[model samples]
Target: MQPNSVSPASEKQHIVIVGGGMTGGLLAVLLAEQGLTVTVLDGAPAPVMPTGPAQLRVSTLTEASHWLLQNSGVWEYLDMSRVQPYDAMQVWDQDGTGEVLFRAREVGAQSLGWLLENGHLAAALYRRAADYPNLHWRCGVAVEGARREEGRWQVRAGDEQWQADLLVGADGARSRVRDWAGISGGARDSGHHALVATIATALPHNACARQVFMESGPLALLPLYSDPQQGEQRQCSIVWSGWPERIARLREAAPADFAAELQAATGEALGEVTLLSERAVFPIQERHASSYVAAGLALVGDAAHVIHPLAGQGVNLGLLDAAVLAEEVERATQSGRSCADSAALARYQRRRRGENLLMQNAMRGFQQLFGQRALPVRWLRNTGMRWVNQAGPLKRLFASQAMGRGADLPVRARPRA
Candidate 1:
């Protein structure tokens, strides 16, 4: 239902969320499912079921994230035919003999992760959210202002105004809600730009995701569904990162030249590459909010932190943020406290910020390590990778982390009984 028809204000705890993209949309559903009133303000129109060929933008959903979607009733709305489950992952260095392979069987799991277009996931979330009567969707409505008054949040969109017990900013990297709330944060460029595109490969991807680390940056070839007519598992999505000038040149190069370069980059691992979609490039930036919560207001997803996409964990981290915040809100309610209790928001921040920071720093370290040109540094990294591959416990540890299996996962993301 559109937000034009205002529901009679009730005593139910209400939440106002700005930005109804993937993360905010999920948050709205999670809160509304708990009997809380949620209103989502999104500048973009309501999402519809994505169709036709895959989009250039995509996201990798880890096992934990998958569980969150399933438990929240969003997974069923997705088109399973478009979901690509990768059973294995391979990482290697282009400059050295450092190679490591992780298979689902090693961890007793059926698949490592699922890859799907970003639009598909967002649309599925909006579809599931529609099932909740308590959820109000304000499509094509931009939040113009936000502030605190009388222990509640006052949000304004054009001439419309809303008050809520809690206010959340899930509006992505350049969150206006965050700015209005006076949350402090900074973004640092990673000195690299990622060029993303969909491609058709001569050889089947074999349900495997692969990445090759070069001095410039890392290039990942993630598996996707095969072409229906051809019925060959050759469809893949590529994220190639490098210096701004280098990425610019690659983005403008002829399709054949680009495909040739892609083939060379992967050492023909997937055989000759054929560009099937237009390429898009985006600068890499690392951002973190100095504090995730202030009073009844909180930030989640990219509004709170944004890390490198090297491991495809950006979306996973955002999903975890939504889950943890929901859990904390539920915990506060059960304990006879307000859903926007400061302690609850603090707990959510405490649980998420450290982990997100760790991953961000880790990615920075990996980039710097691989970017090194010294011979000793190169040998050390290559030998370390080989040793880790040979070490069963270490390999399993890495695999488990990549699959989002950790002790501190929010209750919603945990495996079902």
Candidate 2:
């Protein structure tokens, strides 16, 4: 296709992305690919260096997310060896009494998901973005605020002012763009903080993910490829959820002491564990923005919504937003409409907002069911899970949604089926 024609006097509808994280960077890459000029304004560089005192977090990429990255031309440049695939997941009670298992083999997929470091994925996307001439990377620049002017968006960053046909707020949970757009959000605190850490295990995890549910909350153990320097070292990242008092005690424990406690907490699911690094804690909360778009502004990723980490869907949801928005822009442009046209923006808002609401409701239902302590409720929930695990058709249906395939997505997001 030839480059999009523009009049000498006509503004090119410059798009200003407020965050250079995964969502913002991906959006910039996608929009630039469509022949639009974009400038990503972020306080940090694309390949963000992890701070020593900061915690290391991992993200699980679903099959649908993989498709999005592949389409955006980022996945091909990623280090496949650094990403570990988990074909199966096992969930059981903390006491090792009841259990349920999910396997991609049963659903005829290669794997359920891939576990990878956030930095690795971001680096791959950032490197690919630099190749696009239409994408202007503006790092180490912070945005103070955004306001709507006469038929345009005005953004204040540092000591300068920038104008755009539309502004995207990918800044995160505390999004300044969302605030400027006058969007409200609701939050729920589960009263539990997850203690996340990496540890070396004696036994091989063999590409399996495990989640043990206790009365307090769920404890997740995700296996990753061994580190290069540590030979025969099997590493698994742990997210242990418990009450504040218990978490406080665990945080204060010595490295060896905490490792033992974690091993017992997981019932030696991945074998003996040794703490290899410092512990990090993240409080549990669910947030949802009232609306995704307003006049010449929109929100993506965590800035739009957040859910419980028990299902590992946060990053996946963000990527889905990028995909849907790109499709909307592509469709609008092909039909002789501008990128920020009101009709095009409304189409995006209607579809993405509905999909996010469904996922949020499903997550809330799971949280309520799992947090129940009644004996009858526990037995009923376990039995239901067991039945679901045995039913082939039902299992496939649920797994398809988890993989981000099937009919759950909007019409624009579905590939063929």
Provide the clashing-pair count of each candidate structure. 0, 0
Please write out the lDDT profile of model 1 over residues 327-417, one tens digit for every residue.
Answer: 9999998888898998999999999999999999999999999999899999999999999999999999999999899789998888665
- List model 2 lDDT by residue over 1-417, tens digit each: 111222222344478889988877788888888888787778875474343321258888888887777767888877776778899888887533567788989878879988888887877777777777777767777888878888788777766677788789889888888888989966678777888888878888878888988777788888877676443428877788778788888988998889888888888877778887778887877788988888878788999998878878888888878777777877888898767777878888887778887888887687677788888888888887778878889988887888888454534335434
Judged by lDDT, which candidate is best? Answer: 1
Query: Could you tell me the lDDT of residue 6 within candidate 1?
Result: 44
lDDT, each prediction: 0.90, 0.78
Tell me the deviation in Å of residue 183 in model 1: 1.4
Write down the worst ten-residue block by lDDT for model 1: 1-10
Q: Candidate 2: give its CA RMSD in angstroms.
A: 3.9
Stretches of candidate 1 exceeding 4 Å from the true structure = 1-13
Off by over 4 Å in 2: 1-13, 48-55, 229-233, 408-417
